[model samples]
Each structure stands twice: as C-alpha cells, then as structure tokens.
Target: MQALKEAQKTVVSNAPSAIFPANLDVEYVISFRYANGGQPAQTGDSSTPEEQLEKLLHTLDLAGLRTVVRDGGDGTLLIFTRIRSEKKLLGEIYRSRVRDWLHGIRPAAPEKETQQSIEKEPLTDGERLRLVYSLITLPNSEGGAGITPKQGEWNLVQSIFALHDHDFNKKWLKDWSTKWLIGPEDLKVIRDRFGEKIAFYFAFIQWYFIALTVPAAIGLFAYLFLPAYSSFFAICNCLWSVLFVEYWKRQEIDLAVQWGVRHCSTVQRKRAEFQFDAEATDPVTGEKIRYFPAYRRLMRQLIQVPFALVAATCLAAIIAGVFSIEIFLVEVYNGPLKMILKFLPTVLLSVFIPIVSTILTNFATRLTEFENYENQDSYEAALTQKIFILNFITGYFPLFLTAFVYVPFGEILVPYLDVLNVTVQHFGHDEKYTTSDTGFQINPSRLKAQMIYFVVTAQVVGFVLETILPQVKRTVFKKAKEFDSRRKGIDTQTVLDPPEEKKFLERVRHESELEVYDVTVDLREMCMQVSIFKRWEV
Candidate 1:
C-alpha cells in the first residue's frame, strides 16, 4: 500500500503539462502489468519493470509518437500516446490517400499541393486513429513502432487500444436510438468515427433490414390470403433473393466509392508474424520485399481439409448424441425423475458445445498462424472462414436434424432410442423404459419452436447479454473500485491529477481499462444471421 502511494506520487510528478494541445490528444493507450512480487519476469529476460517501461517509451519516441506514463492502479501502467508531429502525421495521411487514388480505391486524386489539400479536407478522427494504430503495431520494417502487445519481446504489454470519445458516443447512440432508419449522413458519421470496416458493417445491416421488408410483407400476405405451400410465394421469394443480391453488389460498390476506400485491401501492410522464405524487389518501386512460396503455403493450407473434417465429425457426433438423448427423454422415456431429467440434455449441450467450440476455435487460430499469410487481411480472412465453418455446424446442424431427420423419419429413430432407455434402466435400476409402450408421436411443432427460438428469442437474449450486461457489469465494478479506493485512503483526487486536469486524465484512465471493440465479431454475427435466415426460408 505504501509502495502504491509512492507510485501515485511519482505519476503525478511526471504528469505532462496542463495545457494539452489538440496534437497531443490521447488517441491510443498501451497497458502492461508491473512485474512485482509473485509475478514472474519474462523468461530469459531479467530486466526490471522500470527498465522495460523505459525501453518501451524509447521505442515509442523513436516511432514519432508522444507518450505520457501514468499509474493505471492495481499494479498496471498506462502509456497515453498521440502523434508527436502533426506535420509528419498529415504527410503520412496524404501519402496514404494518394496511394489509394493510384490504386483506384479513391475516385479522385489528392491535390498536388499536399499540405494545402490536407488542410482543406483534414483527417477524420477515424483516419487519424487508423494511421496511429498502424504506426504503433506495424513491424519496424514497415516504419511502425514494432510493439506487438502480448507477443514476442512485448510479452508484458497487455493491450493497445484507442480512447473512445464519450461525448460523441452519447450523441451517436442517442441519434441512432431516435431514428427508425439511418441515412447517408449517419453512415458518413460512422465512417468518420469508426473507419470504413465498421461503417461497411452498418451499411450492410441497414441494406439487409430494408431488403427484408419486401419479403416480410409478401410472407404476411401469403399467410393471410394464399393457400398452404403456395408456389407463387416461393417463386416471388426466390426472385426477390436474386434481385437483392444483385442490387446489393452495386450498393456495395457505390458505398466503397463514396467512402474512398474501394480496393483498399490491395494496400494492406505485411503481417509482423509472416515468415518469408525469400526476398524480392518490387518491379515498379524497386523496394525490397519479402516473399513466401505459393506452393509451400498451398501445402500448409491442405492441412485445413483434415482439420475441418475432424472438427465437423466431432461437433456432429456431440450434437447428434445430445439430440438423441433429448428425444428419448422428452418423447420416449417414462422413468423416475422424468421431468427433471428432461433438462439434462440441455445442460449437457450448454456445457459441452462451448468447451468443444473453444478448443476448435483455438486449433483453427493455430492453423491460421501456421499457414502464415503475408498480410493481416489475408490472415484474418482465412481465420474468419475457418470460424464461420465452426459456427455453421454448431448453429444449424441441430436445426437441420430437427427439420429433416427428426420430423421425416422420427418413428424409425424413436424405437432405436430404446437402447438409451435400457442403458439408463440398467444403471439406475428404474422400471423398463421403452418407446414401444410410450405411444410416442413426433411433434411437428418442435421444428417451428426451435426456429423461433433461434430467430427471435436468441437474438433478443444475445442483445441483452452483449449490450446491457456489459454496461451493468462495468458500473458495478467501477463503484466497487471507488469504494475500495476510499477504504484504502488512496485520495485519487489529489494523487492522480491536479484540479485543472483531473477530469481529462481520469477520462483517459477510464478509457484505458475499457475493452477494445473488434468489428470482426459484429461482422461474424451479421453473417450468421443471414445464414440462419436463408436456411429458415429454405
């Protein structure tokens, strides 16, 4: 506790000046735990925590980022960072825009007077944050600080994340909540704040929501006015789907052009983890570049075939076993504790699927790393594909079984569940439980119930878990922290910041602890929703 107080005093003494300039705005934070008692030092590297911190600061300085260190509380340190030279950052942004123009990513070329043009348009918050992230995380060879958090030399570096603008976030959320449908300006705001990757996700979701309206109305009409299994409805559904896909392609292109990020995938930086087998010079730029043989990568990628097979087989077997047990309990069994036992399959499924999925996801990640794509985009794309496969199996396989196998050929399968009943009877010395005497009848409504659960119930539960629960947890944790601080007589009011700068510094510290938002997770969820909708329609 005494050491912590001293550390707080040291932080206050070293805090940057009161008048923080716009150029010095804290865009990113690098956090790491202190290597104190009971915390083992990085293996084979015996540097003390202060020495490691100094080295990291030196690296950031060399990378042209201004950094200020603060005590992050609870044995952690936070390094707040921004571009040191506004002029240099502007030049980098200008060069990036020019490259985009040259590659046909941007519709218009940047003006020849670079600085003047940059001043005219200025860098959006998203553009600045993206470039700063690249500066910090890209390899040294790519002109970045070469600090890969939680990897290699920076093993103690826990995270690197950007600070969120609370004011902007409040306004943005309120605006979105108030609007029934987001317009072009809303999308432009998203692009300026969160970059094109995240903006594209919202754009796709909005497009999908609007397109769904037509089919929804048609389905309603069919339900009210048409005969069961109407051919006209089916034909119209198919046609609408075809037209939606075709038009979305054009919409995607237009959004890309408007955002000035079309064809931006071509300009990806080399992955720091990429291993090169050879070196080559670019034909146009004559710059030395790393090369990995296509055939070698192809051989490594072949391993994915066996991996996918194993993953599918394992997950399918589990789901099938659970599904069978559930069927026997619900529809066939007439044993002791029958009502309570019916929930056992759900419990087993809830426990096992996540454990298995996590194991498979980790394996997929390792496999992706083994494949060693040259760029970040390619690496992420490969991993996303593998994960999507896993998601598809876990998400849809049970539904498929219920719809096709259970409903169509359930009579044959239910009698076979007698084997499970016999096994249970043998173990527990219960009465003979067999489907032959139970007068079992398959519930056709089961499939519809499961569909509704996935389409509506699961989505609502997921939203509450993803959005509401996190906020609640954060609030509780924060209040507890404050209470603990008060109990300890830490006096954060005085030790952490001067009166003039307290609010800003405290905001930075709070933002430092917040989780880094990954747009990929949201994108994956959207993809899963689309896949589920298509399967349900079929």
Candidate 2:
C-alpha cells in the first residue's frame, strides 16, 4: 500500500502520460496478477495451494488489480478497475453475504402488502424424533442418517455415524471434527469388539513402535558393536520398517472404522462451487451443497501427466547441470590450493544446487498452480512431491555421478582426453586432439564428494528450507510491494434493501472475514488424505 501510494507520484510525473492507478497493496496486486493470470478452460485441476488459489481467483474475479486507466492524452487517470468489487470488504461484509446466502436472501422483489399466516398441526412422536435428528445435523447434514435402512447400505451408514462419545473439541461445529487417536468409549468399544487382549496389545504396540526408535537405535548399535555384520541388527531394522508400514496401514483401517470415518468418502468429489442448479439439500447429508460438476472431474485430470513431466524434466536439467559442474571442478581442475580446491568444487556445487533446485521448484509450483485441485491436502501434497523431486535431483545427482561416472569410469573415460595428433607431413600443418596433461585418477577423493553432498549439503538445504528462505521472502516482500489493483469496490447502488445489501456485501468480502462457503468441496479432500488406490476391487 505504501509503495502503491508512493508509485502514484511516479505514475503521474514519470509515466502518468500513459498511466492511471487506483488501489490495493503490493502483495494483493501480486496475488491478483498471478491468481488471475489467465482464464482456465472453465475448469481447473491441481492439488496445490497456488493452483487452488488460481482456480478460486478465476472462479471469482481475477482482474481486480487496481490499474491506472490510461484513457486519454497524458491521462494518468487513476481510474480504478474492479477486479473483484466485493472481495476487499471482508469481516462484516463477508458474514453478511453468507447470512444472505443462507437465508436465500437476494435482490428484493416488488414490495407488496406483507401478510403472515400460521397453521397449527399436532406433532407425533415420530415427527418429533425426525426433527431432533434433523437438528443434530444442523450446520451440516440433518436427518440424512436418521432413517432405518430399507437397503443393506444404510446399515453400513448407520454403523458409520453410530453415536460414539466423541472427545469433544470446542472447535468442532458438527461432524467435520478433528479428533484424537482414540477416545474413551471408542477404546471400550474396540475392546469389546476386538477383545481387550488383542486391542490393548495392538494399541500398545502402535504407541511403542512409533516411539522407541531412538532407544532402538542405541540398542541396535550395542548389538552391532558386540558382533558386527549382526544379522540381529539387520533383522531388527528391516522388521521395524516393515512392521511400521504394515501396522500403520491396518491401523488406519481400524481407526477409520472405529471412528466412523470409513464412509466419509462416499460424498461427491466436486466442490459444487457455483450452485446455479442444486438448491435442494443433499438427501444423504441433508446439507445445502451446491452441485456443479456438470463436467466429469476425470476429464479435468489429464493435466497431471503434463505437470509431472514438466516437473521431472526441469529437475533433471538442473541436476544434470549441477553434476557436470561439480564433476569438472573436482576431477579436472587442478588449480591453486589444490587440497582446499577439492572442497571448492563441492562448495560451488552446494551453492548452485539450491539455486537450481529453487528454479525447478518454482517451475513445478507454477505448473501445479496451473492444475488447481480443490482440496488443500491434495494440492499441498502434489506441491510437496514436486519439491521432493527437485531435492532428489540436486542432492542425489552429484552422488550418482560420483559413484557411476567419476569413481567407476573416470580412469578409462578420462584417458580419452589424451593428446592425439594427426601429422600432415606433406601438407605441413597438423591437427591434434590435445588432452590435458593431468593423469586421470579415481581415489577416495571421489567419496569426499558424496560425503560433502550428503552431510554438508543436506544440512545447508535443511537450514535454508527451514529458516533462511522464509526470512528472505518476508524481507523481500516487506521491502517491495506491487501497486495497481486491490480486492474490491463499493457501489452504494443499494441493490438490496440496506439490510439485505449488508448481508450480500458480507459474502463478497475478504474470505478471512467472509462467510464460509457452506458448500463443502465434498469428500475429495478426505479421499486424497487416505491411500491413493490403484483400482477398486469388488
């Protein structure tokens, strides 16, 4: 905002003849630009923050950046372009919109003499129970799970939502609640069902298995040192890793069933983002989820292959370039401080690795952003995978080169650089392939590269990732902000009566301050958190 304000003077004096500027701060401008960079094909797919943001931006108003509308000669007219007229006014504005949305409040119709009529009907016990059930599901589903199952499927549904005493979280409004690993009644139920011995043992084993690795590490070494090549040590490590994986997998299923979350995935995958059609409440959940997956979600998924490919290629290139430079410096360059210079190659590679990794990461991030998946978990997971790829490349590639290329093949391959001359005796001049004078050597020095890359480079990477990068980003952002465009506008148009308009305006405000789109994006996010299935087997 400060920069935008400051830049306005420049816009007028330096570039005002061609510019007009109005509104919002720098980060919002950058966010707006990237968010609204281009129109998605009416659909977007990605499982990353950036992509979700892009989709949301497009779904709403993408062009809300304040602009200096250059409308005339030396215009410099600070004509504000409303990228999103309602977005900026958050807090009360957002709440008001959601309230209106909930109430089915909209632009008022022609005012007529208002009349109220009340009808009295006696309520039966069955009706009362139904109403009670509906109330329980309020703020979400109501009587969806109340009825006895006419079909076998409802039995499973009954079991899923079977009333178990949840360890109440003050945060939970209804069913979408965060829960502990095990609840008290849940423990009792598991004991009754699975038997106390089996259940207790299973629970205890899970607790200790996840906990004892440190002691286990010490124990492993104690046994290993007693008799190195220790089959016992090997067995323990292998057994622990395998057991952890297998146990966790089964435990997840058990927990899912016990917690009644196993059936959570049956909900639709799409957001029903803009509900132009679905006004009716869901028959199953009884919540007013919008339904706009008019197009198949799978069709939106073809973009993943391309995204993966782009990420892989970019990572590969960075790795290749970094490895080449490291190899050349460590093996070929016999420059000053040769002993210390050996470290120079590593130092240089270490420095370049992050830069290269960052570039690939940025590319992958952009690609993911382009893909726009709805669920934050899926979106973040996809982005995390991309980061992992870049990490693998820069960190692992140098080691790969050392092991396969430099250590194993350097002796023979380096000899090819030897001087070879072809003398043109009759013609007088001769052409020669002059190899460098240094003898090709493969020594423990090759391993040094690996050690440096793994130990030193890993620490460096961790520090930068955990600490430095965030600080740097903050500092840079603080120093500079983008001008031109902001989140909203106010039309005082009184589209709704003052009361209704307040509610409507609230809906359009900043999301932080706005109403939550009560419409869940469905079970897509939850499914993503669970295991990714290759295929479903009946």
Candidate 3:
C-alpha cells in the first residue's frame, strides 16, 4: 500500500582505492511518536517529532550514514541513505573491465572506442544487497544501527517502509510465467524487495523446476509410450531422483555465493526461545557466547526415531485401511450402489488424512524444540525434514500400497472378502460375485488414476487450505468478534492517537499481507511432478 519510491543512485565518474562488492546501498525511513504513560512523568526535554527527526539525521551523519531527508508529516520522517564502504566506488572490477584493459594495451583511440562500447552496453548494477534490512535492524557493532522504522526512539512509530509493490510484483510474476524462466536478475529483484530468505527459496525452486523438466518430459514419454509398469522406467526414475538430490546440494552452494550469504548463519541471532546454561568468550573473536550441551540435545534428538516410526505406523494403518475398503468395494462388493460406495473410502481418507497430518505436525514442532538447535537454519531444516517424512507417509504410502501390494496380489488376497456377501446383498445382480468371476484382479491402471487425482485434485485442495481457508477463517473470526463487541456496546475499530499514524498504518497494513502465495503453488507443483514420476514407475 505504501507508494514505493525506486531506490536509485547516480553514476559515479571517479575510481576508488578498494573494491567492496559486499557493500550495499539501502533506502529506509524512521518514524517515532510521543510516549504515553499513566504515572507522573519525569522531568525531560519535550522535543517535537520534527525536532527529533533533525536530531536523528544529525546522529546518522555521525554514524557515517550519508542521508537525504524529507518530511513525512505527523511524527514520521523519510530518510534515504546509501550504505557504501569508506571508498567511493563499490564492487570488484568484472572480467570485462580486464578485457577492456587488454584493449587499452593497443592503440589509444581503439581502446577509447572499446571502452565506449563497453560503457554503452547496459549492465547489471548494484552490489549484492547482502542483509541491508538486517544491517539497519541491529545495533551498529552488531551489524545494524537499531534505527529501524517501526520502533526506535518512542513508543508510537507507525509503520516501516513497504516490503513490496503489489502491482509491480504481480506484473513481474505474470511476465515470469509468460517467459517460463527466472533469471539471476529476477531473483535479485526479489532479494532487494523482500529479503534473501524468501528469495533463496525462489532461487532453489527455479533451479529445481528447470532440472525437473528433463526427467518429467522423459517420464511422460515413458508413461505414454513405454510398456505399463516397466522396470526400466522405474530404474531411470530412481536414478533421476538420486541425481537431482545430489545436484541440488551443489546448486545450494552456488546460490549461497551468488547471494553473499555463505556466512549468513554465523551472523544469525540466537533464537528468542533458546535457553542458555553458561557463557564463555569466543577464542578467536573474544565475544561472549551462550553455551548449551550439544550431547544433551543429541540425546533428545534420538527420541525422534521412535516418534517418527509411531507417526508413520499410524499413517500407514490409515492408508492401508482406506486401500482395503476401496479394493473390496470395487473388486469384491456386490452391494447396493457399488459405484458410489467405491469412492466413499477415498473421500473419507481425503478428509481424515489432512486432519491427522496436522496433529502430527504439531507434535513434530514440540519434538523439534526438544532437539534445541542453536540456529534458525538447523531448526527449520530439521522441522522441514520431519514434515516431509510425515507427508511422504500420509500422502504417498496409501497409493504405494494400492499400486504395489493390492493390485499385484489382489487375486490371492481379495477372495476372503467374499464372506461379506452373506450379510450384504446387491440389488441388481442375481449371481453371487466371486473371485473367479472377475478373476480377483484390480487394474494396475488404478495407480495412474490415483496419480492423476493426486497431481490435479490435491493441488486444488492444498491451494484452498493454504490460501483461501486462512483468509476465510480470519474474516469470519473478525466478523464474529466485531458482532460480539457490538452486542457488548464496545467499539472494535482501530483508533490512533495521532492522525499521521493512520496514513502510515494504512500503507503498511496492505504491505504486511504481500506474502508470496505462489511459493505454495510452486512447491506443490514440484512435489506432484516428483510424485507423478515415482507413481508412474510403480
């Protein structure tokens, strides 16, 4: 909602002593409001917000911020500053610059023409922004100035700058879809606006999408043209999975270097919930650091093995029960309304699996906390691994059972279900349906059917759960709360002490909701594509 101003810089004509590619140019604002307290106030300087803004700018100058200021009205101010190194120029000389030097070793006029040509060509600019937002978020020695906008000097800071431009990001994504490719520059744009964490996810997935296409195309061909349930296809798919996983590890490192986040984990702050046992000085940095027993944490992590087995067993039992009922209804049941009843098990599984998975996911979070990871990265990784495992069992295991177990062995096993015919009778059929009559066979193509539903239908369901359901729940809750308040004769509408705060809040309110829902879409697409390949092989 904030009207975004493009962060721009003028071209530098002069050279500098050192190349600092890591340095970033960032633009941010700081806003503050007067403190309101019930108790008698202590004697202090009663400076106005405008006067505070002037003082802040002076302090920024002292802290080496070459800032440009503008009035933001009320208790807010807009401050723009370029985070540059002490040197005038930033970044290493590209190889192109060296090539230009080689050209200069020849004739002067030719060298000048080569230089002109190089200069004329448009090039990617801006040093990798590093953690520009982070640098501004912390205290100076700790890497940031603690001059963040949402709060700083007073208790009434209204809003931080907008995280993104809605229209621009929409257009950008539209163009990306039309082009079917995301370049490094596109990822850089995301990093500049949102932050590296989200951008890293995008980058990893973009590479994944591109890599997946080769195998996907091959599998589609095999599914259509190769023999059904081909062992060759299975082997190829397995090989592809292994190759893809290994390749992604190298790709992660490449992206880390490209984003200047190779050392990012080292600077990451301690988790807010992290409890410390002791403190010691870092031998190299001489900084005091919190200490926790790694062995104790590892011992706690050992609990996950049994917990995971229990979760997987519960999910597998659910899946197996669904599969047996489905196979029975389809292959053995001669009961009333057979077609309708055949789908009931699937429908039931669809409803219950997500519910069960949610409960297990909540449990996984507590288990992850028990592991007591030192950094956010490790914590999230472990948690994601747990979710992936839970989903693998809950989502894929049922289909696997149907494809590998039920279909292949239904002839040997399903005949026993004929005993139910004594209790339940079919309306249309006169003859008792037996294993011999239908050959006790379930179609291997049922696997393909399941894959189709998983790929197409599962996506719709996930989108609803991830995007629509949350919005609907929030809206309904808000309305119910408002209605309840009205019944109590209490106002629920937000009221700001200062009028200026209203505009800032309005701008930021929309900005705060600009999360990339496409992330879910992308992840689900990749997952289903992987599932399709694996299922097709079976």
Candidate 1 lDDT at 132 equals 79
Best by TM-score: 1
Ordered from best to worst lDDT, the candidate numbers read: 1, 3, 2
Rank all candidate structures by their TM-score, best first, as comma-separated numbers: 1, 3, 2
lDDT string for model 2 (101-127, tens) is 344442322212111100111222222
Pairwise TM-score winner, candidates 2 and 3: 3
Q: Is candidate 1 or candidate 2 better by lDDT?
A: 1
Top of the candidates by lDDT: 1
Query: lDDT of all predictions, in order shown?
Result: 0.77, 0.38, 0.58
**Residue-wise lDDT of candidate 1 within 1-538, one digit each (tens)?**
2222232232212222122233135667888777433254562377776677888889888887777777775567778777766455756777788888888787788887666666557667787778878889888888888887776667778899876666677888998999889999999988887888888889999889999999899989998999766888878878887888789899999998887777888898887777889888999999999989999999999999999999999999999999998998888887767889998987787779878998999899999999989899999999999999999998899899998899999988777777776566676663554334647798877886777777887788669767897789788987886788778765434255556556666676677666668889888887787777765764
lDDT tens per residue, model 3, 429-472: 45644223555666767877777778777778777877798788
Candidate 1 yields a Cα-based lDDT of 0.77
TM-scores for every predicted model: 0.85, 0.40, 0.64
